[model samples]
Target: MEYTFDQAAALLNMGRNTLIRRLREEGMLGTDNLPTSRWRGRGVFRVITKMYRHPVAGYIHYGRTVITVKGLNAVSRKLRLAQHQPEGSRNRASWVN
Candidate 1:
């Protein structure tokens, strides 16, 4: 299942803004950071956006954004690995096992 930004933030125990920044940094958001294939069948998060306009008012509202379970797991795994790493250690290969 997918999760809205707010829900994902809550699950990760971080502020929504901080979560968003992390997602963007991890290439879980935005098209600019996407690969040449454009994320199709790429096991990455795709942005689902809905534009809304009020019936009586002239205001536009953007809907909540969401990410997939896979993306969330990826984020969680990255965080776990990051937390276990020693500072200033460039030998990430050793972390695999």
Candidate 2:
């Protein structure tokens, strides 16, 4: 099953924005707050877009990023590893698991 960002964050014991920022920093997410192509191909995340008709603006689209089970596991593991990094060791894209 997929989870909304807020739900995923809660499951991961983090705040919503923190998760998004971390994912973006890790190159798993784009500036649009959706999964990047690499991560998407890995079955990590999905963006669901809904369209609504506005009285004056016609169709309006809204996108929401959801985390798959695989994504939750990947992100949770990454966050745990990040917290246990060696002193002076920095977070890097290569270390993302």
* Residue pairs with backbone overlap in model 2: none
The superposed Cα distance between candidate 1 and the true structure at residue 12, in angstroms, equals: 0.9
Candidate 2's C-alpha runs over 4 A off are: 81-97
Candidate 1 has which clashing residue pairs, if any?
A: none
RMSD of 1: 9.0
Which candidate ranks first by TM-score, i.e. highest? 2
Tens digit of per-residue lDDT, candidate 2, span 1-97: 7888898877667789998899888888899997788877777787899999999999999888888766776877766632222224355433335
lDDT (Cα atoms) of all candidates against the true structure: 0.57, 0.75
TM-score versus the correct structure, for each prediction: 0.52, 0.73
